[model samples]
Target chain A: MMTDYRLTSLAKSLPDTVPFVGPETQERARSRLFDARLGANENVFGPSPTAVRAMAETQHWMYGDPESFELREALADHNGITPDMIVVGEGIDALLGYLVRIMVAPGDAVVTSDGAYPTFNYHVAGYGGVLHKVPYRYDDHEDAVALFKRAAKVDAKLVYLANPDNPMGTALSGAEIVEALEYLPDGTLLVLDEAYLECATQNIALPLPLDDPRVIRLRTFSKAYGLAGARVGYAMGAPGLIRAFEKVRNHFGMNRAAQAGALAALEDQTWLRSVQARIAASRNRIAEIARKNGLRTLPSHTNFVTIDCGSGPEFAKAVLNEIVARGVFIRMPFVAPQNRCIRISCGRPAQLDILTEVIPLALRAAELR
Target chain B: MMTDYRLTSLAKSLPDTVPFVGPETQERARSRLFDARLGANENVFGPSPTAVRAMAETQHWMYGDPESFELREALADHNGITPDMIVVGEGIDALLGYLVRIMVAPGDAVVTSDGAYPTFNYHVAGYGGVLHKVPYRYDDHEDAVALFKRAAKVDAKLVYLANPDNPMGTALSGAEIVEALEYLPDGTLLVLDEAYLECATQNIALPLPLDDPRVIRLRTFSKAYGLAGARVGYAMGAPGLIRAFEKVRNHFGMNRAAQAGALAALEDQTWLRSVQARIAASRNRIAEIARKNGLRTLPSHTNFVTIDCGSGPEFAKAVLNEIVARGVFIRMPFVAPQNRCIRISCGRPAQLDILTEVIPLALRAAELR
Candidate 1:
């Protein structure tokens, strides 16, 4: 007789599907590397040379300071907040998982935009939370008002809103989000993910007080700082909520070299400015390429552009598949109406040249299919 | 009115205590750094130069291959097992958290030895698992038979055992552990933590079949491999049990450079052997110092030694405090019997010289107090 492992009902109930299949997995399946990698919105511009040097020079034989005191202090100073208000972790993805575990018990309600970041939904499901998704607006922006209203209806303990939203590259202004807060239920805590805040064209920092218990904001080094491989991200919130992470977090989880890298990266504002400029230029180049292919592009407040394939979800998926087949990697939103578009991350001029060369061909092939 | 951010009942119930207060925290509290850093069982000889170079040379821009395919494949080849049977994470701490989350639900029973690794207990409590702890044997080894018997009696879903145990620096042979397995109940799973295996003088790798569903063994790059700061560890188990980690793990949580560093470290068998020799020499030196100071040192099979203070827990703690004040960092066990001894990690020659100078003074101060 076989031994029964006896996994928890929640674990057993979880589907085998992951939120996003990595480009590396796809490359392995196809047995070829992508010539122009743009699918995941990674900053190809890379981290500051100073940051790279710091990581290389770190004493990696020692465990990272479990409290991540130095990095948290640096982040606090950079954000104009006290160190107690910040909690650093492996990444925004891991932070989301921790937050979901803390807030959502079995059968608890959590709210998110239907086609927003799927990783948040994955965490909710992993924790046995019942997710209630509100659809994106017709303009392809996350409907914050609708999300808050639904949270009220569902009595959700948590509501997720990504400013400068992913998948569609659209965003709501800070004032607009603040106005939407009125609709949020009294007990629901809003998770405002600003992973791409540094990459946005406009200053999108919310004007809410730092001690506001109604919301917690997440930030990452993976975007404009170009240290995604370092796996460093942080949550800024009320001191009480931030202190709660201490109860269950893997205290020594931070990589020493990554912490050093992030600290150095945060100090290099010149590098950040240059990367932001490059991203702006690349976004326009991608839009130009989409226009030449007779496709419309969504106005972006992020590092990626969402191109309307001018048809249904099938057509958009075909376009993505064709691009992947041609050694250019990209992704599309999963849910419909938004699924009629494909998302393309900003890249260097050389990578953009490949995108320029491949778009029309991919479109033709996708249309034929 | 203040906003009510509702945390789950489990989250609210969790205590503020952490698994281990990092040595850095101590240094900060003292407003001075330790002259000899021997507290945490971190390999002071450091990771291989080749590993360091590999990390420095890695691409920090790209997010690590979320599947960690190359590293996993390398690990599989090294262990003489298929890649599917392993799951890599940020560290053993995170992996343990994920494992406990999968097998344990609120009020589920888990078993571990009293005065075993607190991190495992922390994970159990984090998930609301009811932990049943059996006392350590008088010989200072983890009482494996007692643990299994308790697991069976409590109908535990999981039982944790660390060979060449921490805080005590004692060991039971692989054969002894295999023999003790007979006491384990049919449905109970064993978590065999081998974090210090590479540091052990004996070949303690369990001889059981690799596909045994009853056991999952965790290994780390943090000890003899000296990549504790890199935060890399892997779990080996039956394929079905390993596959379940996918349902909840942070797939993209690895630092890219850490993966590169660990792969390079694994390939450098010469560096590992050299570190092993150093650890052995350091252990003998530590025992010699303890003997000179009129204290009894436990026979160690690990990178650290536990020295009996020739008195009670209070005396041992006073000795630890004096050592810290004297700028030679060291620790002691938290629970009774074991708490009568102080633990010290193997250090470099210069560091050991500092320890030699500090130990006598610390003992005198402790006795005087």
Candidate 2:
């Protein structure tokens, strides 16, 4: 029964589950900061020193430009698109929430892979949308075909795909994504999340039908440029969909410091390249460490590496717990099968050293148990 | 006629107007930045230097604590409440949007003063709430009693009141708000916006019923603490309503540097007091300027002063436009007859000097036109 202060029926129906548990919560609960902070896929290498300086120099008394005019212009130049095609926001998480709200109504169908970004699913649920989850193929990449088919079958309003995906650190190439877009249902808009796309640092033009109304790409300063805390992300699409976002978005939401930081970071591509190289090195190191412990790693195009624990979800959970107890913070996928592998983000050498030392120990403890 | 991607019917039905246009947009159009930035009511005194240092020192690579654990603990202590009773978000704007989303379903009623914060009314309309506007009484102050009566009559799910109000520089005391709470409908929740509360800086115990569920009070670092660009704000209320925010809020939405900056800013109460004093001085300067111009100044408890232009909104608009054209940025109330007044924020001495120079010129230009 609905009680005092009548909440929307959709709100009352939502469970009290947060999209992700912040690592700081764990730190507070344990009464100690993690010795090795590698979870949540943060770039421990940090933002460009130039960006930090620029952000720090901002007069915090002034509200940021609601239009994000300069940052969007910079990003448009960076991505070879017109400024009108880009809409910058607090983060991709927020943009996804806004997208879900605009597109989904009660019982509206949305499709995604079963083990895709939990936050996307969280937003869909929050908006009271019916979610259809397609499983991964051969325990690797998200099944694009199944996602397309499901959207068509259910007449889903939206479909979500993250290139260089999180958790599993697997991806669909841009060419593959472009081909799949043709198969999208006539009524469905595809949300192509590229938050991790810059991890490769290739600077190669990703094949995009930017003029297409059916697809929009999400990118962020969080990954390679390392401004996750600044919470700046953008969506690229046709002008119509871009303008539509202005209808529902928190227009005056940009952080003034973040706008400066993002602009500076974009200008400093040298730092991003270096961070990508470092993430690449760290990923290889993690794979090497896992291989030494008789574990196999899924090939990754992103910052993190996921190692198959060769047991079950139970074993992976025990190992993850042990690693946490050993002063390292790492996460794993939520569902079965993928849950058999623990996800570790790229870390600095000292933090990776902790991981280098702890995996085997965690494995032994889990085995003993 | 449903087209290629079905927007939520509500989204499709909404108008495309934004709540407020940023001053930056004005600057961009004019092809020059404003010489005096007084329109938004942001503190010209800026945040504590320690906060700038703390924010600048943040590792921008990591997502902020979704829990906002430390900030909440600090705020809880600061406010004499438990941490659970406070929920921090991107800003008071985002919190208000979230509150309206949770409380008002499509076609539900909401109540507010006729010329109150446009953003709140915008959010209510965004969520498809029917708004009942209670006009100002006693010539300037929002009629709190009228608002309560209208809300009860319309059975509004939500009611918004800005203490130390915006635009008109008027207020309803905490005790007055408490009395209003008693008259609220059974399911109505009052959104008590205290964005300018610290403008007083007197530390008088404003008779707030902080423990009451019927009222949720908003506080922000945007005004007195001079972190408008940082975008940090909080809601204080019953823990249940606080936790309900989790179901809809972007959990990791905070700027990491903003979180740090806020904590440091809070620790530096000396800086806050100093800024408040500056604001008071600026308020006096503005009043003096208005008096010199033969305009009446509304008694202000907030950082900005609303000056009666001694004419209708049309003359105020012409004066306001003349100010903008002269390279000073200022705003007026959007609704009538409140629009008869032009709102000016407390500025730095030089900025106020520009305002003093411009007001007479603006008045002369408006008269000539």
Candidate 3:
């Protein structure tokens, strides 16, 4: 497919397909805007008012702190770690790509679940890392033990697992992950992507020590904080591992407004709590809609629900297309068995109304197809 | 020095340095804020009120157009080129890093001036590209013919030259560049970093045809548009080279506010022209000040002026430090010959007032030292 100038063999082998289509892209393709954007797992409730005010206040400033010193200090105070333990980036997507650049040299083995976040896989493939994908468990939670075993078998340098996994909205317990670590080989770094950590149930194993040499935890203002547009994400790990980012990371990469907005977002716990409540209400409404349609909704600890549509990928695709045609944006899994389920993000009441009204129609349309 | 973890050999060899120390970092280090900031060539006039309003308007939107569809289309209309010929990134810094990643395999040759923007050199080093630096010719503008000769000598895959070159505030004509392109090797890519293009006095170059494969031009909203905090920079080249970015780019990398702000900024050429006029006035004022102090000012096509201190790097450093100590922030060239000059950004009348008040005192202080 690449014709003119030759890219590195690794880049040449990468597929043009991306993990998820942005709603704006879909809107352009459909030639009509979505009436309800409950796809892509974004919080439609939006960022905190305080975050917005902070961003507005800082728009006049020249480039935010390159070291992100103030934000890092505030985050350190909030997360109970020294500033050296964290490295902020454009987003988890950017941070993950940078990590792969550091750890996964050409031909290095990388491990993840078969139905895991495809963007992580895309990055590994982009960097010429050999991917070893283990299959998901019955509940759609990544099988951590299996991932570790595969990493050991392949002598992998990196393994990625997103807690409260995407597409399925399923999560593994901290004990289970800790148990699986026993099987992990030395020198392998575990990239625990907790993008939705805030929305998950309480006591879900957070505040991982900064000195943990083998584990790097990623968190973002994008999801539960309703700041997906800000593009602020941070990684926490041992100081040496974190500092390695300076070698290749864009020192001035962060947006000034994002730094201001994210710092304010982190400080506004009351607003976050309010969003959590709304998310809980929205999730329940989605579950009720699924039940009414004779579908089983997976118990979601995140900001979205995955409902078994009682069909295969073909039927799921039909339902998605039908809903999408009616200006209701939704998505589904990419692989077999999992593809039987469709995913919907938690939005406000108006968005839920659209889904509740359209689900039966979409299901009927799928059956007719 | 990297005790807890072993970085790749390439990362180890890369120096721990950045092109410039940002004002925010300096403020932290000094433990006292500067009264005036006229450094790093950022627009002190601030972004267009329209851009700020637009960003504030869209601050809550999750994920902008990943394709950057609307913005790209609008820019295409503005530039009289197809949208396929453009790719936007965090800033020109990130774009340079990405371009280097694609072109330079380990030990590949990359060419730039000895005293060119060090960030380009930093990117080349980080990517394990062997840097081939040609000295600046006696004339202030980059010697494109000499650069081409060096590129040919080293079989350089990439050649970087910032028109309206920084630190010296010099520029080459569009015709001179086009003439030099004839000598560019078939496989080599010319990275024409025109970060200050809008501020340059010369007749600016239009986006070349989509089939012009030998050169890729970089532009940013950070300069004349006064949106340095926005972190929006774009590259224009043949569609084939531009599309290759998808293979390794962080797909959802852009900030939504930045996308909205840059779109608004690009549309407001009236504001841009006003800024250009202000910058011109400030440059003239700076040159007059230099003459009054028996210093020589170079011909400037950019927003900043580099005044020769009629001494060496040490003397210039003293002057720069004195300026900083007296609450004005300015910089000088990092390498010799050029280091005999100090770079000062065009600021509002008040900022220039501080510079005018401080420079003489600073020079006297340096002489006494």
Candidate 4:
């Protein structure tokens, strides 16, 4: 007899596709490791040595504090808010998934920039929520006002805005975001992903009240703090909204060492400042490389720089493929005008040296193609 | 105007309460740390030194492989299955949540023992699944046959069974489980949680076909391997069922160091064997302590022992409170008949000495109350 493992309609409806394939997957497929792992926007400067030692010294036999009490307390202090205002999770990805689960019912509308974070869209779609996308602004920043207007039109439950946005690597100032918040509908919650905020050159933090119910800001240790492998990120919002996470979150999901690592990373401001300097220097190096190759680089507010390939998506795709073939891992945006650009993460000087050697040759190969 | 976050009806319905309160929270409330950390059934023997070193040496800057390819391959080899048949997740709790989300739509039927893992029940309720509970057998073993029968009656999409059970610390043999499987309905999936299987003395491993679509077996490094803080667990099932996890799982969720730690933990079977020996000895010591205190202990197959308090839930609760007041952290079952017993985890020799010193005093206090 045939056994029926009855998957829910929503589960069956979701496509069996991941939002982003890891570079390691490509390495296995190609049977060779990349010389420069500059694709995933990982901080090449690494986490604080103090944080690494902290993780190493943690007691691994016991379960992490399910409440993540100590880590949340540190995050609150770092952000100048009370512990009740924060909810920590595996990362921004998992946090986004939880937020979507809490707010989006099947057939509910959610709004985001057309080419912003695909992971957010993946979460929205996973929950059977309808997505209404607004195009980016002419300057390549997320058009938050347009997104808010669309949210109002669709009566969307959530509107996602990634300040210092991914893929395009351009950002709107904090003042610009505050001005745009006026257009958001009263019922809509803004999921402001500040994942790259620490690396940005100007308007470093969003100036919103800690108790603002209309917005939930996300921050991560993955980029500037350089603890991506630790899988630590947190959401700062109204205490009531933060408390609601207790209803659905995996209480013991956190890795204990990660909590210790993040707390130490947060406390070590010197390491953060050093990493920021390195990121800035590397961003300039990438822009210099792009200029030498006769390609224009977008003004990046993130650890990665997006370069205009002087052609369409197909040419940029060829360039990316050629770069990968030459053993320097890099990626490109997935949609329309954004797809016309190839994004390169800021890397260590040695990794950037490899990128410097490969890009011109890759461009030449793309031109021939 | 009142701001509305527009949480889904389901979200609003869920109680803002966590399933298990961490010992740290209690410590905060009491303003003192427990002298002996025996609650939560954590393996006090700790993880392999190799596993701890592996995690400490891992690159903390890069994201863990989204596929968790290396660890999955290691797990597959260890389990005598192909990689496609496995899915690694944050922990069993998170995996159960994902399974419930996949199988149970709103109002769909699910089955479990009435006082089984509260986290599973929490997931079912969070997903809006209607649960049909079966009672344990008189000997305190999970009633698998009765659960399958109830699943058939309710047309449950899923049924959860934790072999080598929690709270009661009792288990059915693998042969008995196989015998009971015949009663399971064709459409219902069985979630066989074998978290404490490594510590059990008899019927140590489940005897089931790897390709069995009717069952998904969950294994964790948190207990015997002693890596609870790492939050690593794997599910083994038919390839199709395992692949379905890709549709909704946070692909980038695994902590890199955790993946390394679990992999090393899996390789060190010598460390695992030593831990199992320690657990067995600790269990015997705990049982002896209860017997000396004029209390009977349940036959335990897990890392914890359940002691009959010789009264009702109230007396057991008072005993537990008194024990806590004396600076020993321990827990008890949450339901009737079972609640008449207090649960104590297998602790180190030093920790058990403290338990020996404290139990009589605690019992006397409870008797006076």
Q: Model 1, range B1-369, lDDT digits (tens) per residue?
A: 332458899998998677788999999998999898899999999999999999999989999988889889999999899998889999999999999999999999999988899999999999999999999997888999999999999999999999878878888899999999999999899999999988888898899977688899999999999999999999999888888899999989999999999999999999999999999999999999999999999988888999999888889899999998999888885598788889999999899898899999999999899
Candidate 4's residue-wise lDDT over A252-350, tens digit each?
A: 999999999999999999999999999999999999999999999999999999999988889999999999999998888658878889999999999
* Model 3 per-residue lDDT at A88: 96
Residue B70 accuracy (lDDT) in model 4: 97
Model 1 ranges with Cα > 4 A deviation: A1-3, B1-3
Error of 1 at A330 (Å): 0.8
**For each candidate, what TM-score against the reference?**
0.99, 0.98, 0.98, 0.99
Docking class of 1: medium
Q: Residue B32 error for model 3, in Å? A: 1.3
DockQ, candidate no. 3: 0.59
The reply for model 4, stretches above 4 Å from the true place, is A1-3, B1-3
Judging by TM-score, tell me the better candidate of 3 and 4: 4
Between prediction 1 and prediction 3, the one with superior TM-score is 1
Candidate 2 docking quality: incorrect, acceptable, medium or high: medium
Deviation (Å) of B357 in candidate 1 = 0.6
Off by over 4 Å in 3: A1-3, A206-208, B1-6, B59-61, B204-211
lDDT of 1 by residue, A1-369 (tens): 222678899999997566788999999999999999999999999999999999999999999999999999999988888999999999999999999988999999999998889999999999999999898998888999999999999999999999989978888899999999999989899999999998888987888987688999999999999999999999999998998888888999999999999999999999999999999999999999998889999988888999999999999999999988899999885698788999999999999999888888999999898
Clashing pairs in 2: A90-A231
Q: For model 3, state the Cα shift of residue B150 in Å.
A: 0.7
Q: Give model 2 RMSD, 1 decimal.
A: 1.7
